[model samples]
Target chain A: MTAALHALLWIAVTIGLYGAADWLYRKSGHRAFAHPVLLPVVVLIVIFEASNLDSAKYLASTQVFSTFLAAAVVGLAVPLYRSFDALKENRVAVMVAIMGGSVSGVISALIPAWLLHAPEGLIASLLTKSITTPIAVTVAQSVGGIPAVAAAVVIVTGLVAALIGPSVLRLVGVDDPVATGVALGTAGHAIGTAEAVRRSDVMGSVAAFAMIVNGLATAVLLPLIAAVVG
Target chain B: MIKTLAGIGFLVLLLYAVDGIKQALGLPVPSAIVAMLLLTFFFASQRRVPDFVDQGAKALMRVIPLLFIPPLVAILDVRAMVLSHPVVLFLAVTGSTLVGLVVTGLLYKALVRKRGRV
Candidate 1:
């Protein structure tokens, strides 16, 4: 296939997979098994391996979709903007919660890997397990971790959060929307925020605040902690 | 159409501008995040984002999940290596998430309750 056609084909595959997953998710009444993001990743991997397609070429062809990811991250500003008043109202609580959460996220991820005798690279990658992919990947690279491992860990961490977060919050009696949103955003990052948005716009916006605050805290705090430990 | 495009362009430019400043200052934070902070401050001060920008951003939210697939699929190349230490890695990752979530939730809930009682 020509270069343009190849790229178009990959784009088509991506959109098709996403659409199919969405359809399945709705059909399944939003079960995690039919998750749009998770399902596409699994199916795409199977497709690439089954066809024996060149992975690099496949990545190159689908580069456009990734650009949108960056834009989407920036696009999060709108929700944050919309939530400004709620954020201002609960500024002190939100800030304190995010700070505590970010520190706990880093420590929790690292201490386990340390105890389990995970490799140094894995340790570093786990440090970013709670942040969003783009920021986590950058932090991982800066701290001498494997970026891909960090990204995968981030996705898995998010999946866990998306699946377990709400129930866990309920079980723990974290009923306040602000607290619940902050916890989801802090632990789950983008995916958790997406779930929060599904729950309510206010929760979603608060979750966005939590996500950004957590990202910033992690981005700065991880490197500092890495330096101190080293 | 032009206004929407301009709004998007403005947002994208803000993203790059933050990135540029990050590189110049040698800051550790990610560009998108810094851009997000900048936008937050902008909205806090300006009191509103442009109408077109708001529309464009809301549109992006609808498809945000699609953004994750490429990165997740990219994990395919490293599956063998990551899966090699499957037991320790899985437990570590999942355990950390659960711990992180519960700890954060409880902490936030405590603070909220404290403030409420006051």
Candidate 2:
């Protein structure tokens, strides 16, 4: 009975939050920064602030309500599978983009940190900031950086890219799906993929391919960078 | 079916091998990358990923953005923001993004122009 109740609560909270996020997304006219992915987070923050609630308290209160979120990730597969073909056609550019972008992301983060003489712990986390969370944290731990800081930097970077990606694309005069997909995946990863779906099928496929490859590259290359710095 | 189990087993072992590679090289390899490489290798070796695994992979990628939620939320240390300042954060993000975009665009354009649509 307790388990059942817990499950029910998770479901309720997940749905309620997601639904509210969806409404916010629409309300924001589906803008890049106003995406549903970040909207729920914003709502949660506001609610927390207003109520003076701690994160632990919120998690406990909504433990039962967040279960439906598990299924949300499942739906991302549909677009990925559907857009595989474009990935094939633009394979060369996609590879080039990942190679270039991944290298640059590492350098940009590391070089700046070193130049600024920023905290070493922060530098470690920034090393994996370009990669996704699981890997980012792992890399962070390995390099003596705070995983939490790395995660935050990664999200902020991704959000900034996703928010401004379309404008940049337009300014560059790139209308190609392959370019769009590769660029987003290179910079934004998963968040970019979500926005890519709106642009075209080809973009999402490339984004997925890029995201995975970039993650792999960062994992391998970051250690090398660390070795050099040390 | 046995296929799904086998695929998963293959993926795990593959990741383990990647971890082994990192250790051997004295590198700190992220676990997700290890899994990804395993997946890529599987794709290459089989030259054909099974439909179910493909489905699972896609699903995983979909909510990929959400994986960062816990980390982002944890940044609720309001003190950090005051010290960093939103403008500084925005500048750092924006500047890096532009650098990424411009460098990539120029290099890619030159490479593609030379190669003619690869």
Candidate 3:
């Protein structure tokens, strides 16, 4: 096949696989482990390994999707704007909570990896684990980290938050819906917001609000911190 | 359809502008983020999201996860780096997430209690 045809073929395969994965994710009632992003990636990795296809070529073939990802990130302004009123009502409290969560999230990830002496690239990737995937990937690349690793770490962190974040919050006496939502959103990003939505409308809205704010804040903050510290 | 297209076109224009600004100012922030902030500011100033932008944003948001797949799939290449210190990786991700959740929750609660209905 010509290079163009080859790229087209892989792109089709990726979208088809993602379609199937998303169908399964919805059918499974949006379970954290059954996340739409997970299955297709696993399947693609397996296909790549089994066929001995170069992962770089696959990435290149699907570069259009990455562009869309950037567009989607920019599109996030709509939701952020919609959520502004909710955030405005508790401006100071919400801002402080998000800042605290974002800062601690970065510090906690960094200190552990730093103490373990992970490579600089790995440390940078870990820096954005708590943010949503799109922003995390961008921040990671800016800070000299691997975008793929940063995306993976963000997914894992979201999974962890979806699984036990609420329980942990409850154990610590965080029962209010707003607090629960803020905690989950701040720490979990989109995945945590999913779980929070299942709990209550207030939790859901607040979680969504927090998720966006946290992502925006971290995207701007982490890179600056990386520059300052370096 | 035209409205959606216009919205998307406008967003692309904003992205280009943000990129130019980033380059000129040597800002470390991502252009996409700057676009987001600019869009937010625009909507805030207008006190309403235009129909075209809202349509465009919703259309994009619906398939956002699909957009993430290609990059997420690239993880295969970095598996070795990720798995190198599995224990530390696990600790860093999970521990920080939990700590972040609790800290945000507690702080919000404390602040709300102090100020009343915040």
Candidate 4:
């Protein structure tokens, strides 16, 4: 097969796989484990290993999806714009909570990995674990980390947080919608925000606000911090 | 459909412009983020989301998760590194995420209560 045809074939397969995964996710009532991104990724990885196909070739073949990822990141502006009123109402509280969460999130991830002597690339990737995947990938690449590792770390973080974040918040006496939303979004990004949305509209909007702000702040800050630390 | 497509085209154009600016100015921030901020500002200044932008953004959001797959699949390349320290990595990710969640929530709740008293 010509290179272009090979790429097109893989792209079709990926899209088909994603469709199946989405169906599963819906069928499972949107369980976190059944997330659309997880199954297809696992299946693809298994296929590559079984066939001894180069992962890099698969990544290259799906380059168009990455471009769409960038466009989706831009699309975030729409929700952010819609959430401006919520943000405006409690600007100080929201900003402070998000900043605190973001700082502690970065530090908590880094200190453990550093003490454990994880690889430098892994350590750098951990820096953006709390942010959404696209911005995390961007920051990871900028800071000399592997984009793939960073994306994986992000998904893991989001899943962990979404599963337990609300309970943890309740244990700590954070029952308010705004606080719950802010906490979930700050820690888990999109996955946590989805959970927050399922709880309440107020929670959903606040979570979306916090998630976007946290991502934007990390995207701007992580690279600068990396440069200075180096 | 036409408006949504046009809005997407406009967004792509904006992304290209931001990329150029990022390169010229040597900005460390991602162009997608810069585009997001600029688009947010544009909507704010207009005081309403244009139909095209709203439709376009919704269309894009529908399939955004699909975009994440290719990159996540790239994890195959570093499976060894990840597997080697699975316990430590798991602890760090879960611990940090929990700490972040609790701290942000409690602090926000405390601040809001404090404001209510005042």
Candidate 5:
């Protein structure tokens, strides 16, 4: 394919795919589990891989989709900016929740591995499981873990949060938008935030900041695990 | 504009010593994840951190799906990628996720319930 044609084709597919995803999320009443970000990509990954399509071929055809991703994420700042007032007001509580959530999240993942007698490598990679993919992958690799396994775990972790989080929150009778967003964002990342936005702008906003906070906590905490596990 | 630059700058710094650090530490890490956590913490402590960097980070955060696609796609026959011990691995992953979700959920509530969010 000509470079122009390749770019055009990729852009068209990405936009088309994302459009379908956006519609799905909107259709889902903005639930975290209904996030368009990962689901469509998973489907696309399935198709591309099954068809034996090279990533370079897919990239040549799909680079345009990144524009969509950029727009979506940047657009998130709108809610993030708007909720600054709420975030500022509850900054202290959010901080504590983030730290607690981070430790709890890592422990949650690792404790299971220990119970299952999962290797030290699996446990170490998962210690950063709830964080974003890039971070998760790197953390997984750092502790003599597997990046691919970490990636899968990160996806599943986020997916589980997106799928069942709200219902759980409701079950607990917690309707506080701040808690909802922070919890989802801390545990789920972009997908959670999308769901958070659906729940409430404040939740989504808190979720965004929570993501940052959790990342910070993970960075500081994981190295310590290396010390303690020693 | 500024945010884009900040994000780009963030990426550069992230890519710089993280690989070396990971290698030097000879840790079992995937260098990128460690770098992300470090950046996140560093950004966390600064007074309100740079909104530019935040803006930049937010953009990167958005298309996170894309990052995931490449790898999952690379796996080709993922079912077969299970490396002959698929059940064990799947259990390890799924088990960890369930534990992570339920525990983290309860812990967050427990930690801050007494604080009474504002």
Candidate 6:
């Protein structure tokens, strides 16, 4: 079969699998383990292994999906726009929250890597853990880390943060909606912001702002930190 | 449907345009991030977001999780390195993420109190 044809089939399969996973997640009362993203990915891996399909070929065909990921990032602007009033009013607090979060995110990740004696490559990947995937993968690549590993680590970090972030926020006395949004977005990126928006429109917009600012901050801060550490 | 498609098309164009500019300028930020920033700036400048654009963006949001699968599945290739030191790696990533959340939340609480309602 032509490569294009091969890709078409896989794309259809992927979407079908994802739809099924989404249905299952909803049916199962939205269990974490049945995560639409995670569960579909797991199923894909098993199917590929069973069929002996070349993983690289599948990836090559599905490159279009990655492009959509970029658009999705741009789509985030809608929420920001929707929450413009709150964002404008709290610009200073937002700036402080993101800067504080971004800097601490880098430090918190790096210190543990150093203490654990992780290899340079692993440390490099860990550096981008708090940022969103596209930027995180790019940052990882620039710093000599494995991009795939970095992307995986980024997703896992977001997932874990999204799962536990709200409770942690409450425990720490972060009762304000803006604070909750900023905290989740800064630490969890889009995945965390997904949960934040569920809380309220105000929370969602602030969270989106936090996620975007944090990404930009990490793009600049991480490289500087890497150079300094070296 | 057409409005949604048009909105999506507009976003994709903006994303690629920003990416092109980043490549031309040799900027440090990734194109996706730059696109988001540029879009946000543009939207904010407009004062009122278009109905079609808002609807389109909302549609895209529903599919965001699907877009992530490709990268997550790419993990199969690097499973060896990740699994080699699972304990330490997991600790570093998850532990730092939690720390970031707590520290940021706490700092935000203090700053909000000090600034008096932000």
Candidate of highest DockQ: 6
In Å, what is the interface RMSD of model 5? Answer: 5.8
lDDT of 5 by residue, A151-225 (tens): 766666676676777777667665567777777877776556666765565777788677656765676667677
Estimate the lDDT of model 1.
Answer: 0.79
Cα lDDT of model 5 overall?
0.61
Model 6 stretches with alpha carbons more than 4 Å out: A171-175, B24-28, B115-118
Docking class of 3: medium
Q: Rank the candidates by DockQ, best first.
A: 6, 4, 1, 3, 2, 5
Please give, for residues A151-191, the per-residue lDDT of candidate 4 as tens digits: 88897788778767887788888888889999988999876
Candidate 3 residue lDDT tens string, A10-125? 88988898889878888998775776767887888788889967989888888877666667667767766766676666878988998899888878988878888988988888
Window of ten residues with lowest summed lDDT in model 6 chain A: A81-90
TM-score of 5: 0.67
True contacts kept of each: 0.60, 0.20, 0.77, 0.74, 0.15, 0.71
Cα RMSDs, all models: 2.4, 5.7, 3.7, 3.1, 6.0, 2.3
True contacts kept of 4: 0.74
Better of 1 and 5 by DockQ: 1
Q: What range of 10 consecutive residues in model 1 chain B has the weakest lDDT sum?
A: B55-64
lDDT of 2 at A158: 72
Model 4: lDDT equals 0.81
Error of 5 at A166 (Å): 1.7
Tens digits of per-residue lDDT, candidate 3, B1-118, equal 9998887777777787888888999976678866887888898899999999977766665665666677667767778987797876898779989999999999999999998774
Better of 2 and 5 by DockQ: 2
Q: Fraction of native contacts in model 6?
A: 0.71
TM-score of chain B of 1: 0.75
DockQ of each: 0.60, 0.22, 0.58, 0.62, 0.18, 0.67
Better of 1 and 4 by lDDT: 4
The alpha-carbon deviation from the true structure for residue A158 of candidate 4, after best TM-score superposition, in angstroms, is 3.5
TM-score of each: 0.91, 0.73, 0.81, 0.85, 0.67, 0.91
The digit string of per-residue lDDT tens for model 5 on B1-118 reads 8776666466545555676787888866545444545554554455255666656655555555543444444444334434644544555444444444444455556656666743
